[model samples]
Target: MKKILIAHDGSKSSDKALRKAFELAGKFGSSVTVISVIPELYLTELMDIDRARILETLTGETTRTMEKIKASVKDVRTVRTMIRQGNPASEILDAAKKMKADLIITGSQGRHGAEKFLLGSVSSKLVDYAECSVLVVK
Candidate 1:
Protein backbone atom coordinates (compact mmCIF):
# COMPACT_ATOMS: atom_id res chain seq x y z
CA MET A 1 0.00 0.00 0.00
CA LYS A 2 1.40 3.41 -0.94
CA LYS A 3 -1.01 5.39 1.21
CA ILE A 4 -2.88 4.53 4.40
CA LEU A 5 -5.80 6.41 6.00
CA ILE A 6 -6.61 6.03 9.67
CA ALA A 7 -9.62 7.46 11.51
CA HIS A 8 -8.85 8.34 15.11
CA ASP A 9 -11.35 9.50 17.71
CA GLY A 10 -9.20 9.53 20.86
CA SER A 11 -10.59 6.17 21.92
CA LYS A 12 -8.59 3.18 23.12
CA SER A 13 -9.60 1.14 20.11
CA SER A 14 -8.55 4.01 17.86
CA ASP A 15 -5.17 4.14 19.57
CA LYS A 16 -4.76 0.43 18.88
CA ALA A 17 -5.73 0.98 15.28
CA LEU A 18 -3.22 3.82 14.97
CA ARG A 19 -0.47 1.52 16.25
CA LYS A 20 -1.48 -1.18 13.82
CA ALA A 21 -1.51 1.30 10.96
CA PHE A 22 1.94 2.50 11.87
CA GLU A 23 3.22 -1.06 11.89
CA LEU A 24 1.80 -1.68 8.45
CA ALA A 25 3.10 1.63 7.16
CA GLY A 26 6.56 0.73 8.37
CA LYS A 27 6.43 -2.59 6.59
CA PHE A 28 5.08 -1.16 3.34
CA GLY A 29 6.85 2.19 3.43
CA SER A 30 3.49 3.84 3.01
CA SER A 31 2.51 7.41 3.88
CA VAL A 32 -0.10 7.66 6.60
CA THR A 33 -2.86 10.23 7.00
CA VAL A 34 -4.72 10.43 10.29
CA ILE A 35 -8.12 12.11 10.40
CA SER A 36 -10.31 13.23 13.30
CA VAL A 37 -13.84 14.38 12.57
CA ILE A 38 -16.03 16.66 14.65
CA PRO A 39 -19.61 15.62 14.19
CA GLU A 40 -22.07 18.23 12.92
CA LEU A 41 -24.02 19.85 15.69
CA TYR A 42 -27.65 19.46 14.74
CA LEU A 43 -28.89 20.37 18.19
CA THR A 44 -26.95 23.61 18.37
CA GLU A 45 -29.45 25.34 16.13
CA LEU A 46 -32.29 24.53 18.51
CA MET A 47 -30.36 25.43 21.66
CA ASP A 48 -29.58 29.02 22.56
CA ILE A 49 -25.84 28.62 22.28
CA ASP A 50 -23.08 30.33 20.38
CA ARG A 51 -22.38 28.09 17.43
CA ALA A 52 -18.98 29.57 16.76
CA ARG A 53 -17.90 29.16 20.37
CA ILE A 54 -18.95 25.54 20.42
CA LEU A 55 -17.16 24.88 17.15
CA GLU A 56 -14.09 26.66 18.43
CA THR A 57 -14.03 24.45 21.50
CA LEU A 58 -14.42 21.30 19.45
CA THR A 59 -11.76 22.40 17.00
CA GLY A 60 -9.41 23.10 19.85
CA GLU A 61 -9.97 19.65 21.31
CA THR A 62 -9.46 17.99 17.96
CA THR A 63 -6.28 19.97 17.44
CA ARG A 64 -4.91 18.78 20.77
CA THR A 65 -5.72 15.19 19.87
CA MET A 66 -4.06 15.52 16.50
CA GLU A 67 -1.03 17.09 18.10
CA LYS A 68 -0.66 14.10 20.38
CA ILE A 69 -0.93 11.78 17.40
CA LYS A 70 1.71 13.78 15.54
CA ALA A 71 4.09 13.49 18.46
CA SER A 72 3.62 9.73 18.68
CA VAL A 73 4.35 9.30 14.97
CA LYS A 74 7.31 11.66 14.78
CA ASP A 75 9.64 8.85 13.86
CA VAL A 76 7.47 7.72 11.00
CA ARG A 77 8.07 9.20 7.57
CA THR A 78 5.31 11.12 5.79
CA VAL A 79 2.66 11.22 8.50
CA ARG A 80 -0.12 13.78 7.97
CA THR A 81 -2.99 14.84 10.20
CA MET A 82 -6.38 16.37 9.35
CA ILE A 83 -9.32 17.73 11.32
CA ARG A 84 -12.71 17.81 9.63
CA GLN A 85 -16.21 18.91 10.65
CA GLY A 86 -19.01 16.69 9.38
CA ASN A 87 -20.36 13.18 9.61
CA PRO A 88 -17.46 10.97 10.62
CA ALA A 89 -18.09 8.25 8.10
CA SER A 90 -18.64 10.63 5.21
CA GLU A 91 -15.61 12.71 6.05
CA ILE A 92 -13.39 9.64 6.40
CA LEU A 93 -14.58 8.06 3.19
CA ASP A 94 -14.15 11.34 1.37
CA ALA A 95 -10.62 11.66 2.69
CA ALA A 96 -9.70 8.12 1.68
CA LYS A 97 -10.90 8.75 -1.84
CA LYS A 98 -9.32 12.16 -2.16
CA MET A 99 -6.00 10.90 -0.83
CA LYS A 100 -6.16 7.82 -3.00
CA ALA A 101 -5.38 5.66 -0.03
CA ASP A 102 -4.84 2.00 -0.80
CA LEU A 103 -6.04 0.98 2.63
CA ILE A 104 -8.35 2.60 5.19
CA ILE A 105 -7.99 1.61 8.83
CA THR A 106 -10.37 2.47 11.65
CA GLY A 107 -11.26 1.28 15.12
CA SER A 108 -14.55 -0.29 16.04
CA GLN A 109 -16.42 1.43 18.85
CA GLY A 110 -18.10 -1.91 19.62
CA ARG A 111 -21.40 -0.21 20.24
CA HIS A 112 -24.19 -2.74 20.37
CA GLY A 113 -27.89 -2.92 21.17
CA ALA A 114 -29.94 0.23 20.85
CA GLU A 115 -27.00 2.58 20.57
CA LYS A 116 -25.64 0.91 17.49
CA PHE A 117 -29.08 0.76 15.97
CA LEU A 118 -29.80 4.42 16.60
CA LEU A 119 -26.35 5.81 15.86
CA GLY A 120 -24.86 3.66 13.14
CA SER A 121 -21.19 2.89 13.56
CA VAL A 122 -18.66 4.87 11.54
CA SER A 123 -16.55 1.75 10.92
CA SER A 124 -19.52 -0.05 9.48
CA LYS A 125 -20.34 2.86 7.21
CA LEU A 126 -16.78 3.10 5.97
CA VAL A 127 -16.61 -0.62 5.33
CA ASP A 128 -19.80 -0.46 3.35
CA TYR A 129 -18.99 2.63 1.31
CA ALA A 130 -15.26 3.03 0.95
CA GLU A 131 -13.81 2.13 -2.44
CA CYS A 132 -10.55 1.00 -0.91
CA SER A 133 -9.89 -1.90 1.44
CA VAL A 134 -10.90 -1.27 5.04
CA LEU A 135 -9.46 -2.74 8.22
CA VAL A 136 -11.52 -2.28 11.38
CA VAL A 137 -9.52 -2.72 14.57
CA LYS A 138 -11.44 -3.68 17.65
Candidate 2:
Protein backbone atom coordinates (compact mmCIF):
# COMPACT_ATOMS: atom_id res chain seq x y z
CA MET A 1 0.00 0.00 0.00
CA LYS A 2 1.15 3.55 -0.68
CA LYS A 3 -0.50 5.28 2.26
CA ILE A 4 -1.52 3.72 5.57
CA LEU A 5 -3.65 5.17 8.36
CA ILE A 6 -3.28 3.81 11.86
CA ALA A 7 -5.68 4.68 14.69
CA HIS A 8 -4.19 4.65 18.16
CA ASP A 9 -5.98 5.13 21.47
CA GLY A 10 -2.98 4.95 23.84
CA SER A 11 -3.95 1.43 24.78
CA LYS A 12 -1.78 -1.67 24.75
CA SER A 13 -3.76 -3.19 21.90
CA SER A 14 -3.26 0.00 19.89
CA ASP A 15 0.45 -0.14 20.55
CA LYS A 16 0.56 -3.57 19.01
CA ALA A 17 -1.45 -2.33 16.07
CA LEU A 18 0.97 0.55 15.64
CA ARG A 19 3.90 -1.83 15.64
CA LYS A 20 2.19 -3.96 13.05
CA ALA A 21 1.64 -0.88 10.90
CA PHE A 22 5.31 0.01 11.23
CA GLU A 23 6.26 -3.41 9.94
CA LEU A 24 3.84 -3.20 7.04
CA ALA A 25 4.86 0.31 6.14
CA GLY A 26 8.53 -0.62 6.05
CA LYS A 27 7.86 -3.63 3.84
CA PHE A 28 5.71 -1.67 1.40
CA GLY A 29 7.58 1.64 1.50
CA SER A 30 4.33 3.20 2.63
CA SER A 31 3.88 6.53 4.34
CA VAL A 32 2.20 6.06 7.71
CA THR A 33 -0.26 8.50 9.22
CA VAL A 34 -0.86 7.93 12.89
CA ILE A 35 -4.00 9.39 14.41
CA SER A 36 -5.25 9.62 17.99
CA VAL A 37 -8.84 10.61 18.63
CA ILE A 38 -9.54 12.39 21.88
CA PRO A 39 -13.22 12.16 22.72
CA GLU A 40 -14.68 15.67 22.55
CA LEU A 41 -17.08 15.42 25.47
CA TYR A 42 -14.56 16.89 27.88
CA LEU A 43 -14.44 20.07 25.83
CA THR A 44 -18.13 20.69 26.22
CA GLU A 45 -18.93 19.12 29.57
CA LEU A 46 -16.42 20.92 31.72
CA MET A 47 -17.37 24.40 32.86
CA ASP A 48 -14.75 27.08 32.25
CA ILE A 49 -12.49 24.47 30.73
CA ASP A 50 -8.92 25.38 29.85
CA ARG A 51 -8.75 24.54 26.18
CA ALA A 52 -4.99 24.97 26.10
CA ARG A 53 -4.52 22.67 29.06
CA ILE A 54 -6.75 19.99 27.57
CA LEU A 55 -5.01 20.18 24.22
CA GLU A 56 -1.61 20.19 25.88
CA THR A 57 -2.44 16.99 27.71
CA LEU A 58 -3.82 15.41 24.58
CA THR A 59 -0.90 16.38 22.35
CA GLY A 60 1.67 15.45 24.96
CA GLU A 61 0.22 11.97 25.35
CA THR A 62 -0.11 11.62 21.60
CA THR A 63 3.51 12.69 21.09
CA ARG A 64 4.71 10.15 23.63
CA THR A 65 2.71 7.42 21.92
CA MET A 66 4.11 8.46 18.56
CA GLU A 67 7.62 8.30 20.00
CA LYS A 68 7.00 4.71 21.04
CA ILE A 69 5.87 3.89 17.52
CA LYS A 70 8.90 5.64 16.08
CA ALA A 71 11.22 3.69 18.36
CA SER A 72 9.74 0.45 17.10
CA VAL A 73 10.20 1.44 13.48
CA LYS A 74 13.70 1.52 12.02
CA ASP A 75 12.78 4.21 9.49
CA VAL A 76 10.81 7.01 11.18
CA ARG A 77 10.98 9.44 8.29
CA THR A 78 7.86 7.97 6.67
CA VAL A 79 5.67 8.38 9.75
CA ARG A 80 3.40 11.33 10.41
CA THR A 81 1.21 12.06 13.45
CA MET A 82 -2.13 13.79 13.99
CA ILE A 83 -4.35 14.38 17.03
CA ARG A 84 -8.05 15.07 16.61
CA GLN A 85 -11.17 15.45 18.74
CA GLY A 86 -14.39 13.57 17.96
CA ASN A 87 -15.98 10.15 17.91
CA PRO A 88 -13.13 7.74 17.26
CA ALA A 89 -14.65 5.70 14.48
CA SER A 90 -15.90 8.62 12.39
CA GLU A 91 -12.71 10.55 12.88
CA ILE A 92 -10.60 7.59 11.80
CA LEU A 93 -12.64 6.99 8.69
CA ASP A 94 -12.72 10.71 7.87
CA ALA A 95 -8.97 10.98 8.29
CA ALA A 96 -8.43 7.98 6.05
CA LYS A 97 -10.64 9.47 3.38
CA LYS A 98 -8.89 12.83 3.63
CA MET A 99 -5.49 11.22 3.34
CA LYS A 100 -6.64 8.93 0.56
CA ALA A 101 -5.22 6.06 2.51
CA ASP A 102 -5.07 2.61 0.97
CA LEU A 103 -5.56 0.84 4.27
CA ILE A 104 -6.57 1.45 7.88
CA ILE A 105 -5.02 -0.29 10.88
CA THR A 106 -6.80 -0.34 14.23
CA GLY A 107 -6.75 -2.25 17.50
CA SER A 108 -9.67 -4.30 18.78
CA GLN A 109 -10.83 -4.69 22.37
CA GLY A 110 -11.90 -8.29 21.58
CA ARG A 111 -15.42 -7.75 22.79
CA HIS A 112 -17.91 -10.32 21.53
CA GLY A 113 -21.34 -11.90 21.94
CA ALA A 114 -23.57 -10.27 24.55
CA GLU A 115 -20.91 -7.76 25.57
CA LYS A 116 -20.36 -6.63 22.01
CA PHE A 117 -24.07 -6.63 21.40
CA LEU A 118 -24.61 -4.26 24.30
CA LEU A 119 -21.49 -2.09 24.00
CA GLY A 120 -21.16 -2.02 20.23
CA SER A 121 -17.59 -2.26 19.01
CA VAL A 122 -16.00 0.42 16.86
CA SER A 123 -14.15 -2.06 14.66
CA SER A 124 -17.40 -3.72 13.61
CA LYS A 125 -18.90 -0.40 12.51
CA LEU A 126 -15.68 0.61 10.75
CA VAL A 127 -15.54 -2.63 8.83
CA ASP A 128 -19.02 -1.90 7.55
CA TYR A 129 -18.51 1.74 6.57
CA ALA A 130 -14.89 2.15 5.57
CA GLU A 131 -14.30 2.49 1.85
CA CYS A 132 -10.81 0.99 2.06
CA SER A 133 -9.38 -2.08 3.69
CA VAL A 134 -9.25 -2.26 7.51
CA LEU A 135 -6.96 -4.41 9.62
CA VAL A 136 -8.03 -5.17 13.19
CA VAL A 137 -5.24 -6.07 15.59
CA LYS A 138 -6.31 -8.02 18.63
Candidate 3:
Protein backbone atom coordinates (compact mmCIF):
# COMPACT_ATOMS: atom_id res chain seq x y z
CA MET A 1 0.00 0.00 0.00
CA LYS A 2 1.11 3.57 -0.63
CA LYS A 3 2.45 5.56 2.28
CA ILE A 4 2.12 9.31 2.80
CA LEU A 5 3.89 11.33 5.49
CA ILE A 6 2.43 14.45 7.06
CA ALA A 7 4.42 16.91 9.16
CA HIS A 8 2.24 18.46 11.81
CA ASP A 9 3.16 20.99 14.54
CA GLY A 10 -0.15 21.94 16.21
CA SER A 11 -0.45 24.96 13.93
CA LYS A 12 -3.43 25.79 11.74
CA SER A 13 -1.27 25.63 8.67
CA SER A 14 -0.07 22.24 9.69
CA ASP A 15 -3.66 21.14 10.17
CA LYS A 16 -4.41 22.17 6.61
CA ALA A 17 -1.46 20.15 5.48
CA LEU A 18 -2.91 17.23 7.36
CA ARG A 19 -6.17 17.59 5.48
CA LYS A 20 -4.35 17.64 2.19
CA ALA A 21 -2.55 14.49 3.12
CA PHE A 22 -5.80 12.86 3.94
CA GLU A 23 -7.15 13.79 0.54
CA LEU A 24 -4.16 12.41 -1.28
CA ALA A 25 -4.21 9.25 0.76
CA GLY A 26 -7.85 8.71 -0.11
CA LYS A 27 -7.10 9.18 -3.76
CA PHE A 28 -4.23 6.73 -3.75
CA GLY A 29 -5.70 4.26 -1.26
CA SER A 30 -2.68 5.02 0.86
CA SER A 31 -1.93 4.75 4.53
CA VAL A 32 -0.93 7.86 6.43
CA THR A 33 1.82 8.39 8.98
CA VAL A 34 1.33 11.58 10.96
CA ILE A 35 4.57 12.85 12.44
CA SER A 36 4.99 15.65 14.92
CA VAL A 37 8.46 17.03 15.40
CA ILE A 38 8.87 18.47 18.85
CA PRO A 39 11.21 21.42 18.59
CA GLU A 40 14.70 20.95 20.02
CA LEU A 41 13.93 23.69 22.53
CA TYR A 42 11.91 21.19 24.59
CA LEU A 43 14.84 18.76 24.65
CA THR A 44 17.61 21.19 25.51
CA GLU A 45 20.19 20.46 28.21
CA LEU A 46 19.01 23.50 30.20
CA MET A 47 15.62 22.00 30.98
CA ASP A 48 15.19 19.31 33.59
CA ILE A 49 14.86 16.00 31.78
CA ASP A 50 11.34 15.40 32.96
CA ARG A 51 10.85 12.45 30.67
CA ALA A 52 7.39 11.61 31.92
CA ARG A 53 6.12 15.18 31.59
CA ILE A 54 7.56 15.61 28.13
CA LEU A 55 6.22 12.30 26.88
CA GLU A 56 2.80 13.00 28.35
CA THR A 57 2.54 16.39 26.72
CA LEU A 58 3.72 15.09 23.38
CA THR A 59 1.37 12.13 23.46
CA GLY A 60 -1.66 14.21 24.37
CA GLU A 61 -1.09 16.81 21.73
CA THR A 62 -0.31 14.29 19.04
CA THR A 63 -3.42 12.31 19.91
CA ARG A 64 -5.65 15.35 19.64
CA THR A 65 -4.10 16.38 16.34
CA MET A 66 -4.38 12.87 14.98
CA GLU A 67 -8.04 12.70 15.90
CA LYS A 68 -8.81 15.87 14.01
CA ILE A 69 -6.90 14.73 10.96
CA LYS A 70 -8.44 11.29 11.06
CA ALA A 71 -11.93 12.72 11.19
CA SER A 72 -11.33 14.40 7.87
CA VAL A 73 -10.32 11.29 6.05
CA LYS A 74 -13.23 9.90 4.02
CA ASP A 75 -11.45 6.76 3.03
CA VAL A 76 -10.59 3.66 5.00
CA ARG A 77 -6.85 4.16 4.84
CA THR A 78 -4.85 2.81 7.76
CA VAL A 79 -3.09 5.36 9.95
CA ARG A 80 -0.06 5.55 12.18
CA THR A 81 1.27 8.30 14.46
CA MET A 82 4.79 9.24 15.45
CA ILE A 83 6.35 11.95 17.57
CA ARG A 84 10.03 12.83 17.49
CA GLN A 85 12.24 15.57 18.90
CA GLY A 86 14.59 17.45 16.60
CA ASN A 87 14.82 20.21 14.02
CA PRO A 88 11.48 20.22 12.21
CA ALA A 89 12.82 20.17 8.66
CA SER A 90 15.45 17.50 9.08
CA GLU A 91 13.27 15.43 11.34
CA ILE A 92 10.43 15.51 8.82
CA LEU A 93 12.71 14.46 6.00
CA ASP A 94 14.21 11.70 8.08
CA ALA A 95 10.82 10.39 9.11
CA ALA A 96 9.64 10.35 5.53
CA LYS A 97 12.72 8.43 4.52
CA LYS A 98 12.42 5.93 7.36
CA MET A 99 8.74 5.35 6.64
CA LYS A 100 9.34 4.98 2.93
CA ALA A 101 6.68 7.57 2.24
CA ASP A 102 6.02 8.38 -1.37
CA LEU A 103 4.95 11.94 -0.63
CA ILE A 104 5.81 14.50 2.06
CA ILE A 105 3.08 16.99 2.96
CA THR A 106 3.70 20.13 4.99
CA GLY A 107 2.18 23.57 5.35
CA SER A 108 3.74 26.88 4.37
CA GLN A 109 3.29 29.62 6.95
CA GLY A 110 3.34 32.20 4.15
CA ARG A 111 6.13 34.25 5.69
CA HIS A 112 7.79 36.53 3.18
CA GLY A 113 10.56 39.05 2.71
CA ALA A 114 12.51 39.93 5.86
CA GLU A 115 10.56 37.58 8.09
CA LYS A 116 11.24 34.63 5.83
CA PHE A 117 14.82 35.74 5.43
CA LEU A 118 15.35 35.79 9.16
CA LEU A 119 13.48 32.57 9.76
CA GLY A 120 13.92 30.23 6.87
CA SER A 121 10.73 28.42 5.86
CA VAL A 122 10.71 24.75 6.83
CA SER A 123 8.50 23.86 3.85
CA SER A 124 10.93 25.55 1.50
CA LYS A 125 13.86 23.63 2.89
CA LEU A 126 11.96 20.36 2.80
CA VAL A 127 10.87 20.96 -0.75
CA ASP A 128 14.47 21.47 -1.74
CA TYR A 129 15.93 18.54 0.18
CA ALA A 130 13.30 15.82 0.50
CA GLU A 131 13.90 12.69 -1.57
CA CYS A 132 10.21 12.23 -2.36
CA SER A 133 7.60 14.54 -3.82
CA VAL A 134 6.63 17.41 -1.51
CA LEU A 135 3.19 19.00 -1.46
CA VAL A 136 3.34 22.40 0.24
CA VAL A 137 -0.12 23.26 1.47
CA LYS A 138 -0.84 26.95 1.77
Candidate 4:
Protein backbone atom coordinates (compact mmCIF):
# COMPACT_ATOMS: atom_id res chain seq x y z
CA MET A 1 0.00 0.00 0.00
CA LYS A 2 1.25 3.46 -0.87
CA LYS A 3 -0.97 5.24 1.62
CA ILE A 4 -2.44 3.94 4.88
CA LEU A 5 -5.00 5.77 7.03
CA ILE A 6 -5.54 5.06 10.72
CA ALA A 7 -8.64 6.09 12.72
CA HIS A 8 -7.53 6.66 16.28
CA ASP A 9 -9.52 7.67 19.35
CA GLY A 10 -6.95 7.06 22.12
CA SER A 11 -8.59 3.84 23.27
CA LYS A 12 -6.64 0.65 23.94
CA SER A 13 -7.94 -0.93 20.76
CA SER A 14 -6.96 2.13 18.80
CA ASP A 15 -3.47 1.98 20.29
CA LYS A 16 -3.16 -1.58 19.01
CA ALA A 17 -4.33 -0.49 15.59
CA LEU A 18 -1.74 2.27 15.57
CA ARG A 19 1.03 -0.20 16.32
CA LYS A 20 -0.20 -2.50 13.58
CA ALA A 21 -0.35 0.35 11.12
CA PHE A 22 3.21 1.36 11.95
CA GLU A 23 4.36 -2.20 11.53
CA LEU A 24 2.72 -2.46 8.13
CA ALA A 25 4.09 0.91 7.12
CA GLY A 26 7.58 -0.21 8.08
CA LYS A 27 7.24 -3.34 6.02
CA PHE A 28 5.71 -1.74 2.94
CA GLY A 29 7.34 1.70 3.13
CA SER A 30 3.90 3.25 2.98
CA SER A 31 2.96 6.69 4.21
CA VAL A 32 0.70 6.73 7.27
CA THR A 33 -1.98 9.30 8.05
CA VAL A 34 -3.71 9.27 11.43
CA ILE A 35 -7.13 10.91 11.71
CA SER A 36 -9.15 11.75 14.82
CA VAL A 37 -12.63 13.23 14.60
CA ILE A 38 -14.61 15.18 17.17
CA PRO A 39 -18.23 14.14 17.00
CA GLU A 40 -20.92 16.78 16.56
CA LEU A 41 -22.02 18.50 19.77
CA TYR A 42 -25.45 17.00 20.01
CA LEU A 43 -25.68 17.19 23.79
CA THR A 44 -24.39 20.73 23.90
CA GLU A 45 -27.10 21.77 21.48
CA LEU A 46 -29.68 20.86 24.11
CA MET A 47 -27.91 22.80 26.84
CA ASP A 48 -27.54 26.57 27.08
CA ILE A 49 -23.82 26.51 26.30
CA ASP A 50 -21.43 28.51 24.21
CA ARG A 51 -21.22 26.33 21.14
CA ALA A 52 -18.25 28.11 19.62
CA ARG A 53 -16.23 27.96 22.83
CA ILE A 54 -17.00 24.29 23.29
CA LEU A 55 -15.95 23.56 19.76
CA GLU A 56 -12.73 25.51 20.21
CA THR A 57 -11.89 23.59 23.34
CA LEU A 58 -12.57 20.30 21.63
CA THR A 59 -10.38 21.29 18.71
CA GLY A 60 -7.51 22.11 21.04
CA GLU A 61 -7.82 18.79 22.82
CA THR A 62 -7.86 16.94 19.53
CA THR A 63 -4.74 18.79 18.41
CA ARG A 64 -2.90 17.78 21.56
CA THR A 65 -3.92 14.16 21.10
CA MET A 66 -2.67 14.16 17.53
CA GLU A 67 0.60 15.73 18.62
CA LYS A 68 1.19 13.00 21.17
CA ILE A 69 0.44 10.36 18.54
CA LYS A 70 2.93 11.97 16.20
CA ALA A 71 5.58 11.93 18.91
CA SER A 72 4.95 8.27 19.69
CA VAL A 73 5.53 7.34 16.07
CA LYS A 74 8.48 9.60 15.49
CA ASP A 75 10.48 6.76 13.98
CA VAL A 76 7.99 6.31 11.19
CA ARG A 77 8.74 8.46 8.16
CA THR A 78 6.02 10.24 6.22
CA VAL A 79 3.56 10.22 9.10
CA ARG A 80 0.75 12.77 9.02
CA THR A 81 -1.91 13.68 11.57
CA MET A 82 -5.33 15.27 11.01
CA ILE A 83 -8.17 16.48 13.23
CA ARG A 84 -11.72 16.69 11.89
CA GLN A 85 -15.14 17.60 13.26
CA GLY A 86 -18.16 15.52 12.26
CA ASN A 87 -19.37 11.95 12.35
CA PRO A 88 -16.27 9.84 12.85
CA ALA A 89 -17.05 7.26 10.21
CA SER A 90 -18.04 9.77 7.55
CA GLU A 91 -15.05 11.98 8.18
CA ILE A 92 -12.68 9.04 8.14
CA LEU A 93 -14.10 7.75 4.87
CA ASP A 94 -13.90 11.19 3.33
CA ALA A 95 -10.28 11.54 4.42
CA ALA A 96 -9.39 8.16 2.94
CA LYS A 97 -10.98 9.11 -0.34
CA LYS A 98 -9.19 12.44 -0.39
CA MET A 99 -5.86 10.81 0.43
CA LYS A 100 -6.43 7.89 -1.94
CA ALA A 101 -5.45 5.56 0.83
CA ASP A 102 -5.04 1.92 -0.11
CA LEU A 103 -5.92 0.74 3.37
CA ILE A 104 -7.95 2.11 6.31
CA ILE A 105 -7.29 0.75 9.81
CA THR A 106 -9.61 1.43 12.74
CA GLY A 107 -10.30 0.03 16.19
CA SER A 108 -13.58 -1.56 17.25
CA GLN A 109 -15.28 0.34 20.07
CA GLY A 110 -16.90 -2.91 21.24
CA ARG A 111 -20.28 -1.34 21.79
CA HIS A 112 -22.93 -3.88 22.71
CA GLY A 113 -26.62 -4.09 23.56
CA ALA A 114 -29.08 -1.41 22.47
CA GLU A 115 -26.44 1.11 21.55
CA LYS A 116 -24.77 -1.15 19.05
CA PHE A 117 -28.09 -2.23 17.62
CA LEU A 118 -29.42 1.30 17.32
CA LEU A 119 -26.23 3.02 16.26
CA GLY A 120 -23.63 0.80 14.69
CA SER A 121 -19.99 1.21 15.69
CA VAL A 122 -17.71 3.47 13.70
CA SER A 123 -15.57 0.56 12.55
CA SER A 124 -18.60 -1.25 11.23
CA LYS A 125 -19.77 1.80 9.36
CA LEU A 126 -16.37 2.27 7.76
CA VAL A 127 -16.14 -1.38 6.80
CA ASP A 128 -19.59 -1.30 5.28
CA TYR A 129 -19.22 1.98 3.38
CA ALA A 130 -15.55 2.61 2.71
CA GLU A 131 -14.56 2.12 -0.91
CA CYS A 132 -11.06 0.99 0.09
CA SER A 133 -10.07 -1.96 2.24
CA VAL A 134 -10.75 -1.51 5.98
CA LEU A 135 -9.11 -3.31 8.86
CA VAL A 136 -11.03 -3.26 12.15
CA VAL A 137 -8.74 -3.96 15.07
CA LYS A 138 -10.14 -5.28 18.30
Q: What would the per-residue lDDT of candidate 4 be over residues 36-113, giving only the tens digit for each residue? A: 998888874465557777888888887988898888874567999998889988999999999899999987663232
Error of 1 at 84 (Å): 0.8
Show model 2 residue runs off by greater than 4 Å: 42-45, 50-55, 110-120
Cα miss at 123, model 2 (Å)?
2.1
Candidate 3: worst 10 consecutive residues by lDDT? 110-119
Query: How far does residue 6 in candidate 1 sit from its true spot (Å)?
Result: 0.3
Give the per-residue Cα lDDT of candidate 1 at 50: 76
Model 3 backbone overlap count: 0
- Model 1 lDDT-worst window of ten: 110-119
Q: List per-prediction Cα lDDT, in the order shown.
A: 0.85, 0.79, 0.77, 0.84
Model 2 has an lDDT value of 0.79
lDDT string, candidate 1, 1-138, tens digits: 899999988777788899999999988899999999988888845554677778889899889989988887844689999999999899999999898999999887732323533423888899899999999875
TM-score of 1: 0.87
Model 4 clash pairs are none
User: Which should have the higher TM-score, number 2 or number 3?
Assistant: 2
Put down candidate 3 lDDT per residue, 6-79, tens digits, no spaces.
88887777777887888778888899998887666544564465766776787788778767766766784698
lDDT of 1: 0.85
**Using TM-score as the measure, which candidate wins?**
1
